[model samples]
Target chain A: MGPEVMPLLENRNDIDLVLWQQDCACDRKWFLENVQGATAIIVMFGDKVDSELFEAAGPQLRVVSTMSVGYDHIDVKEISKRKIKLGYTPDVLSDAVADICIMLALMAGRNARESMAVVNEGKWPNYSWAPFLFCGRQLSSTATSQRTVGFIGFGRIAHATLARLIPFGYTHCLYLANPSSAPATARDAALAAQHHLQSVQRVDADTLAATSDVVFVLAPGGAATEHLVGARFLRRMKPTAVLVNASRGTLVDSDALATALRERWIWGAGLDVVTGEPNIAADHPLVKEPRCVVVPHIGSATIETRIDMATLAVNNALAAIAGEAMPASVEF
Target chain B: MGPEVMPLLENRNDIDLVLWQQDCACDRKWFLENVQGATAIIVMFGDKVDSELFEAAGPQLRVVSTMSVGYDHIDVKEISKRKIKLGYTPDVLSDAVADICIMLALMAGRNARESMAVVNEGKWPNYSWAPFLFCGRQLSSTATSQRTVGFIGFGRIAHATLARLIPFGYTHCLYLANPSSAPATARDAALAAQHHLQSVQRVDADTLAATSDVVFVLAPGGAATEHLVGARFLRRMKPTAVLVNASRGTLVDSDALATALRERWIWGAGLDVVTGEPNIAADHPLVKEPRCVVVPHIGSATIETRIDMATLAVNNALAAIAGEAMPASVEF
Candidate 1:
């Protein structure tokens, strides 16, 4: 739901394509009007790829590529039954998301909004210069010459974000990854060690949330992880903690996050991905809260990332139709 | 003139010293009106303390205690010839001034204003997120685990500011102090070595301005150092350089600074002192220019620093009148 990805179809015709750019709720009238003549349909989260639509599209339909990682929009059972190819863009935007996470962390910790309000209010004369007028949190160094950074997820973006924080005087990193199978957990441990981070034994989510100075939510967002940072998880956080979310909107409940900010459950929250995209009004509890800094979902919107994504999406469609290996085809 | 140092008091107690505090300028008018019976005057800068005012106050005036570092407003020659004791506040606000210098440097280099403006203006969503949206020059880290910080003046606040920048990544410091004094240069070099700075060399102003990534103007302010950062010195700077000034308003020419910022003479400027202090309105040339940030002189405005200054000023008056050592008298 960022910008229309149809700019991907501007002129390249090496591959025959069927563009069904439906971004709304799935309906029989909408599906029959456009998707019936397509070889493949590029749909987002809201569109349902039910049996009726698939049958309506008929024999020419060769692929169903959901723009998002989650494919709840598509009835995957029917797609697998027909053995159609699928594609999604992930990992590519991790760096962008990570960058936003850090931006939010710094902005929230510094109380940038309130500080700016001071200057704008024309109260500079009455306000005496002080050693610490708006001193909030130090992002980098500590009195001990060592600072600890923590992440709630150990995904690609989380690692990249960790790399950025290292230069800011972070010497220790704590991470909480979803409990993995034996082989995957071993890989995770090795990755953590490679990054010079200790692979502390996986603990409950509450422990990770409590101990981290900065907790980043970069996990997969679905029913299994809904409202992961509710009141209980929030209460466990350090008083000076900063929470960042660049993953999915549903991973956090906005009401819970707002309450935490209001009651000082945590120092601040930087949210790039809120529970509902674009629908968050200024009056939304979190938006109105001083400490909670909300940014519109722009995690993967960098020029380099966007161009790479477009090229990959195009290649994925072409390769799927030509019966070739797609660069980043979704396994699920 | 800063709000702290502007009033010229005429009477020993016109505005009821214990209550009904007035602006420094108002206090100056009150002092002028009531000076005929006054024995001493507790004054700040910007009030004309000349032969006329002295003659008006008559021969009873024994001392003049200025609540500021600079005494350009008072005729030192007249005071010396008259044998009246003079006192001015110094050494108190050095740390506070240093803090503001560092804050401005960090804020400018990070493009904090522009990014915050974008968010405030609601252009964040249309503008895609990127890894380098506001990637500005990081002042602290450079040259292999250590940063080399150079100052144009090795005064008290410059040393204090250097100390603050040390933990952020500065390991080497270079300085240019009073050109005529070799002993002053040696003292600074020894201090730098004590702080673990690689070297502190006394270079000419031109060389100091050129080689430094962040050049601070912390020298005494007066006619002797007017327009120090003119066309030639700015031309020699790196494109990523930042200039911080917390010393005096007259030290930098506002027009030249605006031109430098517009022409990219150096990366940006963090100015707590300008050509004119509070007179810098919205349409001021520097205010109109991008990358040139200006703050009304609020150095030493912290609660602790202010209380110390007020107490010191009061103590200086008491000591001068009672024939004891003035706590921090500015001896010429």
Candidate 2:
């Protein structure tokens, strides 16, 4: 938690807090034992709030607040049955995550990994200037090539990313939304008008993969969306296109992505999340790929955004303990 | 030159081309000996053009075209005195260079160098989640904290960078220009209106350094402006602020910046150009700083941009040799 959040919880005159003061996440065993007799417990994205956790906390558990937008770690079905109010931070982190999306897109397309290596590994002295050396794909549009940006999911964060791209001269946007939701023509037109884009169209997955100069996987991660950017999608993409994923790890297949880069199916990839993360091997295929730029999941790891998320989580916990509504909450 | 440039020169039956077929820059000794009777000579940024070169070409050098925006490598005064038309690429690369300015800002503020190391160096397995781990400064605005961006020179490239920053929620823009030119309030207001900014104010160097959250050095490089961002200017800056230099290295003193980062006068720096570049030692002070992120001076090194520059340079040479006005020319 942020330094401010601890004081916010401890300074409340009406509340008594059991704080896990370490920098790392609280251990599962420590959480289960210390959570007893608590009215509310604050958790992180790595924690699981399940039947086991509910039984450990007893009937006194009234609220479970998490300092993240997604609650995949928690068992929503069990939490709903127990009627525990779930508080989470969603809108607070859109700008931070969206910022990383552009950073990754620009970095990957600009060959940042290779260029930095030249400077960092002491090869810059020998690697002098050339006209086209170290050149990569251009993100912005020119008269000859108008840029087209595609999204796997079009939510709030995606919208924020699109707004940033408009000034870069991306005139067209093609997105793949959940098929269950109808394509709203009015909303699409409004979005186009708001950003002054040439076109904003809903497209099928294959078309989105083939047409976009840059493809962003911003979909939610779950069983339904697992391996959504697998071989078929990679194969359909333009050879010059770049891929960026500031979203979930499960939505992309590592093996497929590695093959795509190796075979030149796509130009490059900028990934914030990977499958089996937090224990990713040094020799992971995607990690070894020259064209792939990967970072630890730092989509919302800005100082301001992290503090805001922590503050919101603490506030939600305090509000739910007083039987009031959370500042932000999940339906479950 | 790009692959296409060689073909563009070779396919033209009307022109006889002397091509240096190599990946690296042409050797100066070889260039002088072979240019005995050339009407036009195309050069890279590393080449110098002066009286000796004009004498070697036997006064047939009517045009000296360079594949860059900056003509610091060429002797513009002598070229103008000798009635030689000088051609350079300017507007073609503004977008590309502006793209890098934002890239550096995002990379420095978000600690991309550190975060990538966590994954790339195999530290991710043990570097588990913590609230503030790897957290750096935020670039965008929130309801509580609006953003202020500053520039050292408010030219075309600076304006392009400002356009990119608007969507990042920067509300105010402060800038320092050549003091000889009078401030235009009408122009400032017009710029503010065009970008929907809260304010676009002209200020002194110290005020720009002290008030800005991020300061970009975008001025031209020369003796008059050398070391403009020296010790005194760095001292007045916000501790949380970031400094980005994409314009020219002569504008900033590298030693002063090194001390600033070490002593926490500023949070970090992102640099594309450094003083005494292309031969920067491994133990160079700025390169040794953990808070600094540096790349080779590749501001206009995008495939599309470089090709445009090269194409423009070639066309300018051809037109000037034919006694027609060059496509893009420098008056001095």
Structure candidate 2, residue pairs in collision: none
Give model 1's DockQ, 2 decimals. Answer: 0.08
**Which candidate achieves the best lDDT against the true structure?**
2
Model 2 accuracy (lDDT, Cα) = 0.89
Residue A279 error for model 2, in Å? 0.7
Query: Mind giving the per-residue lDDT tens digits that candidate 1 earns over B170-216?
Result: 66676766657555656766777766677777777677777777888
- Candidate 1, position A291, lDDT: 85
* Candidate 1 CAPRI grade: incorrect
For candidate 2, report its TM-score. Answer: 0.98
DockQ measured for candidate 2: 0.76
A-chain TM-score in candidate 1? 0.84
**Model 2: lDDT of residue B259:** 100
